[model samples]
Target: MASSLLIMQARLASSRLAQKALLPIYAGKPSLLYAMQGVYGVADAHVLACDVASFSSFEPIAQEAGFAIMAGDADDVLARFAHVAKEYKVDYVIRATADNLIVGQELVRLALDGAIDSDADYFCFEATAHGSGVEVIRRTVLLDAYANASSPFEREHVTPYIYGHPQRYKVIKPVVESRFFAPDLRSTLDTPEDYTRLVEFFTHRAFPSQTIIEEYIAWMRSNLYQMSL
Candidate 1:
C-alpha cells in the first residue's frame, strides 16, 4: 500500500473573514479542529500545514485534534506542502483546506483509492459539493509543482499547476453519485456570510466532525430551498 498523508492547509490571515479558522463551529470547537477531525484515519498520517503567523495560534487547536503542525511561507502554500511531502516521504497526498468544514473521511478515502487504482497524478471528484471534496495527488507530481510552478496563483492554490497542464500531468475526475453532485451548493467559509450561514446551520446541530457528507449536502440544499421561498 502506498503511504498517504492528509495535509490540511490553513492560515489565520483572511481578507474576507478574519480568523475564521478560530471561529466556533459546533460545541464551541473551531472550524480547524472539525476540519482536521473530518479527514482523520483515512490517511496514514495527518498534518496541519500553515504559515509562520498561523502556527502559534493554530498549535493548540491542531494539538487538540491530534494533527501535526508544519509552518512555512505565507503565500507559497505549494512550497509548504512540498516540504511536508518530502519530509514525510509520503507516496500520495490528500490536499484539504480548513475553509471546507464539511469534508468527510469517506470522500478522502474515495479520492485516495481512485488515485491509486488509476495511478493518477492529480485526482478529484467531478461536480461534488465544493467544501466536501479534497484533491489527491502523487508525491512526485506535487514536487514537480513546487519546483517549477512560477505563477503566484499556482503556488498559492497548490496542485493547480499539475491539473492546469493536462498534457504534462495525468488528471482524474471521477463522477460522484447523483446525490453528491451539487455544483450550486457552497460550503466553503471565505466570507462573513459564509461564516454566519455555517454557524446558523451547524452550531445547534450534531458534532460536525461526525456528520456524514450526505447530511451536509441535504442541509445545504434544504437551506437553499428555504431561502428561495
Candidate 2:
C-alpha cells in the first residue's frame, strides 16, 4: 500500500498573527517542530511551505529545524497542495494545518483508514465550526478536485471544492466521542492573543508529553466557566 500521510501544510504567514507556526512553544523549539513531531508517530510527515518569492526566508529555518519542506504558491493553496501530493506521490493525504498541533495520532490513523477503504472522496471530522481536528482525503479524489475546480475561492482554499461538491464524489466522516463545545482550548496557533494564551500555558509545562490537547483539556476543566462562556 502507498504511504498514508505526507505533508503537513504550514507556513510563517498569517495576516492576524505573523509567523504563528514558527513561534516558540516549549523546550526552546519552534511550534512547527511540535506540530511536526506530534504527527510523526502515526505516519510519515513533511512540512509544506507556502513558497513565496523574496518573502519566504523561513523555508531554510523549517529545513534546519528538521522538517522536509516543499514549495508552491502562497495564495493558490490548492495548487500548492497538489504539487506536494504529486511530489510525495501519496495514496492519501491527511490535511492537518500547522496551527492544529493538538490533533491526535490514533484519530489520524483511523480516519485515514476509513477514507482509503471506503469510496469516500472526503472523510472529515465535521462539516461545521467545530470541525477542528484532522481531515483525510484520497489521491484520486484530490486529483479530481484539483483538476476541475476553477473558481478563485476553490483554488485559493484547498479541498473546499471537493467537500462542497459531494454530489461529484463520495464523502465520509468517521465517528468520534464528542459533544462538548471544547472552545478550541486555544489550540491551532492563530492570532497574537492565541499565542499569548498558548505560550503562557505551555511554558509552565514540558514538551511532547505535555501536548496542546492535554494542556487545554486540563485548563478547560479548571477554568470551565471561562471556557464555557
Candidate 3:
C-alpha cells in the first residue's frame, strides 16, 4: 500500500477576507481548526502547509491538531506541495485548502481510494459541493507538474497542470453520489459575506460534529432559506 499525506494549505493574507482562516467561527475556535478537524484521520500523515510569513499564525493550531507544519513559497503552491511531498516521502498526496471548512472526510477517503485503486495521476469527484471536496494526486505527478509547468496559474494552483494536460496524466473523476452532489452550493470562506454567513451557520445551526456532507447540505439549505426570508 502506498503511503499518502494530506496537506492543507493555509495563509493569513487574503484581500477579500483577510486572515479568514484564523477568524473565529464557533464559540472560540478559528475556522482553520474546523477545517483541520474535518479531514483529520484519513491519510497516513498530515501536514499544514503555509508560507514562511504565515507559519507563526498557523503553528499553534497545527500543533494542537498534531499536524506537521511546513513553510514554503507563498505564490507557487505547486512548489510548496511538491516540497512537502518530497520531504514526507509520501507516494500520494491528498490536497486540501484551509478555507474549506467542511471538506468531507468520507469524500476525501473515497477520492484517495479511487486514486490508489485506479493508479491514476489525479483523482477527484466529478461533482461536489463547492467546498466539500479534495484532490488526490500521485507524488510523481505533482513533482512532474512542478518541474515542467511554466504558467503562473498552473504553478499557483497545484494539480491544474495535471488536469489541464489530460493526455500527459491520467485523471480519474468518479461521479459523486446523488445525495452529495451539490455543485451549486458555496461553502468556502472567501469573502466578507461568506464569513458572516459561516459565522451564523457555525454558531447557531451546526451539529456537534459538522464535517459530514449530508449535515452540511442540510444546514446550508436551512441557512439559505433563512437568508432569503
On TM-score, the candidate that comes out on top is 1
Write candidate 1's Cα lDDT for 131-210 as tens digits: 77899999999999999999999999998899999999999987976767777677788888788888887865666444
The pairs that clash in candidate 2 are 121-170
What ranges in model 1 sit over 4 Å off? 208-211, 225-229
Question: Against the true structure, what is each candidate's TM-score?
Answer: 0.94, 0.83, 0.93
- Among the numbered candidates, top lDDT falls to 1
- lDDT (CA) per prediction: 0.86, 0.66, 0.85
- Point out where model 2 deviates above 4 Å: 53-56, 64-66, 127-132, 179-186, 210-215, 225-229
Cα lDDT tens digits for candidate 2, 138-167: 877777788989998998768789889778
Question: Residue 167 CA error for candidate 1 (Å)?
Answer: 1.3
Badly placed stretches (over 4 Å) of model 3 are: 204-211, 224-229
| Steric clash pairs (candidate 1) | none
C-alpha-based local distance difference test score of model 2: 0.66
